[model samples]
Target: MLWFLFCLALLLGGYYIYGSFVEKVFGIKKQRQTPAYEKEDGVDYVAMSTPKVYLVQLLNIAGVGPIFGPIMGALYGPAAMLWIVFGCIFAGGVHDYFSGMLSVRNGGASVPSITGKYLGNNAKHFMNIFALVLLLLVGVVFVSAPAGMITNLVNEQTDMNVSLMSMVAIIFAYYVVATIVPVDKIIGRFYPFFGALLIFMSVGLITAVVVSSEHTLLGDYELSQMFVNMNPNDLPLWPALFITIACGAISGFHATQSPLMARCIENEENGRFVFYGAMIGEGAIALIWCALALSFFGSVEALSDVVATGGPGAVVYEASFGLLGVFGGILAFLGVVILPITSGDTAFRSSRLILAEYFNMNQKTMRNRLLMALPLFVLGGILTQVDFGIIWRYFGFANQTTAVMMLWTATAYLARHNKFHWIATVPAMFMTAVVITFILNNSSLGFGLAMQTSTIIGILATVVITVYVLTKSKRDLFVNEDGNAIDDDGIEVVAQDS
Candidate 1:
C-alpha cells in the first residue's frame, strides 16, 4: 500500500511540476514563431495532431530500457520495484519531458545542442562524444540482450537450431529495412502498428500467464534476502540505489528519445502529455516485467539457470508465456523479436539525426544514412556474439555514469531556469552525488587515487567554465562589437524577435 502511494505521489508530482514548467517554456512568445525549418510539410515538420504525437511519443520511448531495467531492478527485490516505478514518474519522466520541450524551444536541437547552448562549445563537444559512445554501448547491449533472449525462446519451444534461430531473427532486420528504407512515409505509418502489437502481445501474455498459474506468488523468498546476499563491505543501499538507478531512475537514452520525439510533436501543448505520459507508460511496463519476473522465477538460482540455459530473452518469454503451451511460445517470440528491432531502429534513427545535424548532411539521402548506420549495426552484431555478461556490466556502469551527466545537466538547467521543483532536483542531486561518492569510495587506494585526481580535474574544468559563463553573463560581455551575444559555438547569438 505504501509502495502504491509513493509511486502515485511521484507520478502526480512529476506531471504537475514538470507539466507546469513545459507550459511556461513554450509560453515564451518567441516560441510561437515557427522557425523556417519547421515550416516544412506537415507530414514531417509542421505540427502534428496531439493524438498522433502522443502515439508516436509513446511508441518511440517504450523500448528495451523498460524491459531490462525492471528485470534487473527486481534483482534488488520487490522493494526496489517501488523505487523503480516511482523514479520513472518523478525523475525519468520529468527529465525526458523537459528535455523535449527544451529541444523544441531551440528549433528541434538535440540534447548536446542544449548542453552547448548553456555549457559552451567544449562542453558541447564532450557531451556529443559522450552521447555517441553511450548510444553505441546501449545499441550493443540492448540488441544482444533481446536477441539472446529470443534465440533461447526459439530453441526451447521448437526443435529449431540455436544458430538457425539467430539467423531468422537477423533476417527480420531486412523486414525492418523494408519498413524504414523509405524512411519518411513507411516508418511513420507502420512503426505504430509494430508498437501496438508489442503492447498487446506483452499484456496478453502476462494475463495468460497469470490466469493459468496455480499459485499467486512463485517464491517464498523475502525482499531482505537481496541485501543480505550482497557484499557487506560494498557500498550501502543509498549509494547502490543511486548508482544502479539506470535500470529504474533516469537514463541518458531519454535524452536521445526526447529530440527524436520532439520532431514528431503536433502541438506545443501536447509535449507534456506525450513525453511524460510515455514515461508513465514505461513505468507501468517496468512494473509488469518485475511482476512477471517475481511470479515466474522461484529463486535467484532458478532464474540464473533459465537465463544461462535459454538466454535472458528466452527465459523471459518462456516464463512469461510458458503457461499457454505452444500458443504462448509464439506470443513470447513475437514480443522478444519486436523488442530489439524497435530499439535498434530508434537508436539508428537517433544516431543518424545527430550526424545529419552536426555534419549538415542531406536529409533526403537514405543511402547515406544507411551507410552511416551500417557500421554501428555491424559493430553491435559482432559484439552480440561475445560474452554478454562482461559487455552488460561495462554497459551498465557506463550507461549509469552517462545518466548522471544528464541528471546534472538537467539539474543545472532547472536551477538556472529558477524552476527548482525539489521533487525532481532532490532525487537527481541525491542520486548523482551518491553515485560519484560510491565510485570514489569503493575503489582500491591506487585506482581510487587516480580516479579521484581525474574527478577533481573534471570538476575544476566544469567549475572554471561555469564561472566564465557567469562572469560573462553579469558583465554582458557575451555580446560582440556588433552587440550580439555568443551562442553555443561562441559564435554570435541571434534571437529572432517575437
Candidate 2:
C-alpha cells in the first residue's frame, strides 16, 4: 500500500509540478488563437472543448497499451512503478505536451511537417516514412487483436455467422468510413462515452484492490530489490524494461496520436490540461495494473511464473476476474477491446492527414479522403495475416525511435527560442541510449551485438546526437527581419498564426 500510494502521488504531483513547468517554458499564451479556431475545415480541424479533447487524446494514446505493457513489465519487479511514474511525468507527458503544442503552433500540421521546420528537410522526410509505417502497424495490430477477440466472444456465446477474417473485413469497412468522415461524426461522438467506460473499468479494478479483504496487492515486494532488475529471466533492464513498458511510460506512438486532438484543442492555454493530464491518467492506469499483478499473485516469483505461463492476455484475464468477479471481468474485457478502435481509426486518419500534407492535398472532400485511406485499409487487412509477434517487436522499435526523433525536434524547437533545451534534451538522450542498447542486445530483432559493446556504442551515439543538435541550433539563432525563421531556402513560414 505504501509503494502503490506513493506511485499514485508521484503521478499526480508531477502533473502539477513538472507539467506546470513545461507549460510555463512553452509560454502557453492565452490571447493567441489555436488551430481549432483558425483552421476550421470541419473534416479534421473541427474545434472542441478542452475536456472532450483530453478524453479523445487519452483514449487515442492509451487504449490497452498502459494495461498490456505494465502487466508484462511487472515481471521486471517494482522498478515498473518508477518507470510508469517518472517516465510518464518527465518523458511521456512532456513529449505529448510539446508534440501537441508544436502542432498547434504549426497550424495543426502532422508531426512530419513540424519536424521539417525544426530538424531540416532530411529529418522531415524520415518522419514521413516513420509515421506512415508506425501508423500502419498500429492499424494492423489494433485491427487483428479486436477482430480475434470478437470472434472468440461469438464462438463462446452463439454459433455466430462470423469468422476472424470476415470480422477483420467488417472492421476495415468501419475504419474507411471513420477515416474519411469529419472528426465530429464518428470518432468525436464515440470517444467520450467509450473513454468514460474505460476510466470506470480502470477505477473499478483500483477500488477492488484497495477494498478487498480476500486479496491484497501491496507490500509483497520490497522497493530495494524491485529497483535492481529482479527479472527471473535475467533480462537486462536497459532496453527490455523500457521497451516492455513503452506505452505506459513513454511512447513515440503518443506523439503521433496527439495531432488528432491538436486539431480540436480550443485554446493554447488548454494544452496542459489536454496533453499532460491525459498522460498522467494513463500513467495511473499502468501503475494500478502493475500493482495488481505484483501483489495479487502472492509473490514476485509467483507472478512471474503466471506471466511466463499465460503471457500478457492471460495475466489480464486473471487479474480482471480474479479481483473484480465475473461481471467485472466482462467490463474489463470490453474496455480493453474497445480502446484500440479509437486509436486504430485515428492511426488510419493520421496516415491520411500526413499523406495529404505531404502533397498539399485538400481533405475536406470525400474523394481525396478515400484515395488516401483505401490503400491503407487494404494494406492493414493484408498485414493481419502475418504473425503478430514479429510485427509487435518491430512496432516496439519504431515506437521508441520515433519518440527519439520527436524529442530531438522538440529540443531544437526550444533551443531556437533560447529556453532551457535540456528539459527535452536530457530525456531525448536517455531514450537515444535505450533504443541503441535495445537494437544491440536484441540482435535477432536488430543488430546482433554484445551487451558491453552495445552499452559503449549507446553512450557514444548519445554524445554524437547532443553535439549535432547543439551545433545545428547555433546556426538557427537568427530570424529574418520579419521574425520568420531563415532557412537555406529563405524565410520559411512554420509558425501558426493561431
Candidate 3:
C-alpha cells in the first residue's frame, strides 16, 4: 500500500513538476496559431474544446494498456511500480508531448510525416508501415476484447441474442462511421461520456483497494530494489517486465494517437495538458489496476494459479467479482467493454488519415475517407481470426520498436532546435537495446538465443544507432528560428518555412 501510494504520488507530482519543465523546454507560444485554428478543415483539423480534446486523447491512448498491461506486469512483483512511475514521467509523457507538439507545428500531420521531416525519407517509409501495423494491432486487438467481454457478461453463445460475430459487426460499423465523420461529430460527442465512465470506474477501483476488508499489503509482494522474482513463468526481469507493461510504462502507440488530438488542439499551451497529462492519467489508472490484481488474489501463488487457468481477461472478471460483487461486476464489465471500443474507433480514424496523407488525397469528402477506411477494416476483421496469442506477442515488441523511432524522432526535433536532446535520446537508446534484447532473448516468440549473447548484440546495436543519430542530429535539416527546416547548402542559410 505504501509503495503504491508513493508511486501514485510520483505520477501526479511528475505531471505538475516534470511535465511543466518539459513544457518550458518546448517553448510554447500562444501567438503561434495551431493547425486547427490556422487550417480549420471541418473534417480532421477542426478546433475543439480543451476538455473534449483531452477526453478523446485519453480514450485513444488509454484503451486496454493501463488495465491489461498492468495486471500482467504485476506478476513480476511490485517492481512494476518502479517502471510505471519513472517510465511515465520520463519516457511516455515526453514522447506524447513532443509528438503532439510536432504535429501541431506540421499542420496536424501524421507521425510518419513528422518522422520524414525530422528523420528523413527512409525513416518516413519505415514508420509508415510501423505505425500502420501498430494501429491495426490496437484496432483488431481491441475489437475482440470488447466482444468477448460483452459475450461473457451476457453469457450467450448464439448468433442472434449476442455473439462474437454480432459484436464484431457492431464494433466495426461504429469504427467506420467514426472514421468517416468529422472530429467533433461522433468521437468528440461520445468520448466525454466514455471519459466520465473511465473516471468513475477508476475511482471505484481505488476506493475498493484503499478501504477493502480483504486487501492489505503483503511484504513478499512489496517492491524493493532487490525485489524477489514472483512471476510464475520465472521470466528474466530485465526486458520482460518492461515489454509486458509498455502501455503503463512507455508506449509507442501513444505517439500515433497524439496526432489525432493534435488536429483538435487550439493552442500550444494545451499540448502539455492534453498529451502529457493524459499519459499521467493513464499511469494512475494502471497503478489502480495493478494494486487491485495484487490484493484481490491475496497471494502471488493464488494470482498465478488463476492466470494459468484463465487468461488476463479472466483475471478482470474474477477480480471484479471478488471485490465488487454482481452489480460492481457489471459496472466493471462496462468499463472493460467501453475502453477498447473508444480506442478502436480512433485507431481506424488514424489509419484513414495516414493513408490519405500517404497518397496525397483529401479527406474532406466521404468518398475518400471510405476509400481509405474500407480496405483497412476488412483486413482488420480478417486478422481477428488469426491466433490472437501470436498477434499479441508480436504486438508487444512491435509496439516498443515503434517507440524507438518516436523517441529518436523527438530527439532529432530537439537537436534541430538547438535544445538538449538527451532527455529523449537516453530513453530512445534504452528502448532500442530493450527491443533488440527482447527479440534475441531465448524465448520462442522471439529469436532463440542465449541471454548473454543477446545482451552483447543488443548493446552493439544500441551503440551503433546512438552514434548514427548523434551524427544525424547535427545535420538533419536543422530548423531556423521560425521552426522550418533549412536547406543544406554551404555557409549561407537557406530559409525553408512550415
Candidate 4:
C-alpha cells in the first residue's frame, strides 16, 4: 500500500512538475493564435474548451492499453509499477506534449507531415504507411474485442441473444459516423461522459480494495525488491516490461492521437493539460489496476494462474465482480466495452485525416470525407474476418517504432531551435534500443539471438543513430536574414504566425 500510494503520488506530481517544465521548453506563446483558429474547418480544426479537449484526447490514446497492459504487467509484480510512474513522467508525457503542440504549431498537420517536416520526406512517406496500417490494426482489434465483450455483457445481463457479428456491425457503423462527423458533434460531446465513467470505475475498484477485509493491497511486494525479476515465466524485464506496458508508459499511438486534439485545442498553453496531463491520468489508471491485481488475488502466484487460465479479460471481469459486486459488472462493461469503442472511432477518424492531409484533399465537403473514409472502413471491415493475431503481435513493435520516430523528430526540433534537446534525445536512444533488442531477441520477430547479443547490438545501434542525428541537425540548421531558422530541406523551423 505504501509503495502504491507513493507511485500514484509520483504520477500526479510529475504532471505539475515535469509536465510544466516540458511545456516551458516547448515555449508556448500565449499571444499566438493556435491551429484551431487558424485552420478552422469545423470538421477537424474547430476550437474547443480545454476540459473537453482533454477528455477526448484521453479517450483517444487510451483504449484498453492502460488497463489491460498493466493487468498483464502485474504478473511480473511491482516492477511494473515503477515503469508506469517513471516512464509516464519522463517519456510518455513529453512524447504526447510535443506530438500535439508541434501539430498545433504547424496548422494541425498529421504526425506523418510533422515527421516529414523534421525527419525528411522519406520519413514522412514511411510514417504515412506505418501510421495508417497501425490505425487499421487498432480499428480492427478494438472492434472485435468490444463487440465480443458487449455480446457477453448483454447475454449475461439479460436473456437477449446478441450475436457477435451484430455487435460488430453496430460498432462499425458507429465508427463510420464518428469518423466523418464534425469534431464537436459525436467524439467531443460523448467522450467526457465516457472518460468520466472510466475514471469512476478505476476509483470505485481502488476504494473497494482498500476497504476490503478479505484482501490486502500489493501483498508482500517490497520496494527494495521491486526491480528484481518476478516474472513467473522468468522473462527478462528489459524489453518485455517496456513493450507490455506501452500506453501506461510511452506509446507511439499517443503521437497519432495528439494531432486530433491539436486541431481542436484553443490555445498552445492547454497542450500541457490535455496531452501530458492525460497521459498521467492514464498512468494513474494503470497503477490502480496493478495494485488491485497484486492485492485482490491472494498473491502474485494467484494472479499468474488467473492470467494463464482466463487471460486479462478474465482477470478484469473476475476482479470487477469480486470487489464491486453487481456494480463491478457494469464497470467491467465500461472498461472492456466503452473504452475500446471510443478509441476505435478515433482511429478511423485519424486515418481519414491522415489520408486527407497526405493527398491534399479538401475535407470541408462530405464527399471528400467519404472518399477518404470509405476505403479505410472497407479495409477495416475485411480485416475483421482474417486472423490478425500474427499481425497484432507486431503492433507493440510498430507502436514503439513510431514513438522512436516522433522522439527523434522532437529531438531535431529542439536542437534546431537551441532549446534543451537531451530530454527527447535520451528517451529516443533508450526506446530505439528497446525496439532493436525486442525484435532481435524475440523468436517470432527476429533472429532469436541471445539477450546479451541483442542488448549489445541495440546499444551500438542507438549510438550510431544518435551521432548521425546530432550531426545532421547541426548541418541542416541555417538562419536566413530574417533570423528565422530553416532546415536543410528549406522548411521553416518555426512559423512566424501560429
lDDT of the structure predicted as candidate 2:
0.84
Q: Output the better candidate (1/2) by lDDT.
A: 2
Per-candidate TM-score against the hidden true structure: 0.77, 0.94, 0.94, 0.95
Q: Write the per-residue lDDT of candidate 2 for residues 1-498, one digit (tens) a residue.
A: 888888899899999999999898777768878888888998899997777788889999985578878988888788878999989998999899989999988889899998898889999999999999999998898887677766765675577667888988888888888899999988788798888888898888878887888777666666576567777788777778888898898988888889989889888889998998999999988998888888788666888788677566667777777787777777887787887778898999999999999989898899999888888888887888899778778888898999999999889988776667788999999999999988987877878789888889999999999899878986776777777654332435355410
In model 2, which regions exceed 4 Å deviation?
157-162, 479-498
lDDT of 1: 0.59
Q: Lowest summed-lDDT stretch of 10 residues in model 1?
A: 226-235
Better of 1 and 4 by TM-score: 4
The alpha-carbon deviation from the true structure for residue 57 of candidate 2, after best TM-score superposition, in angstroms, is 0.5
State the C-alpha lDDT per candidate.
Answer: 0.59, 0.84, 0.84, 0.86
Show model 3 residue runs off by greater than 4 Å.
156-161, 217-226, 477-498
Cα error, residue 52 of model 2, in Å, equals 0.7
Better of 3 and 4 by lDDT: 4
lDDT, candidate 4, 1-498, per-residue tens: 888888998999999998888887778878889888988888888888999899889899888788778988988888889999999999999899899989888888899999998878988999999999888988997898788777877788789998989999999999999999998999989898888888888888888888988877865666776777688887788888898888889999888999999989988878899999999998998899888888888667899999888667778888888888876767755665688899999999999999999899999999999999999999999989976466557777888899999999999888877668888999999999999999999998788999999999999999999998877776777778997776433655566311
What does candidate 3 score on TM? 0.94
Kindly give the number of clashing pairs for every candidate. Answer: 3, 0, 0, 0
> Model 3, 1-498: lDDT tens per residue?
777788889999999999998887766778888888887889898899899899889889888888989988878777777789999999999999998998988889999999988888999999999999999998998888888778767873234467688988888888888889998888888898889889888888768766776676443363453256677778778888888898888898888889988988988998899999999989988888887777778765777788787678888888776678888978877887798899888888888899999999998999889899999998999999987777788889888998889999988877766566788888898899899999998467778898899989999999998888778877765555776555322222322211
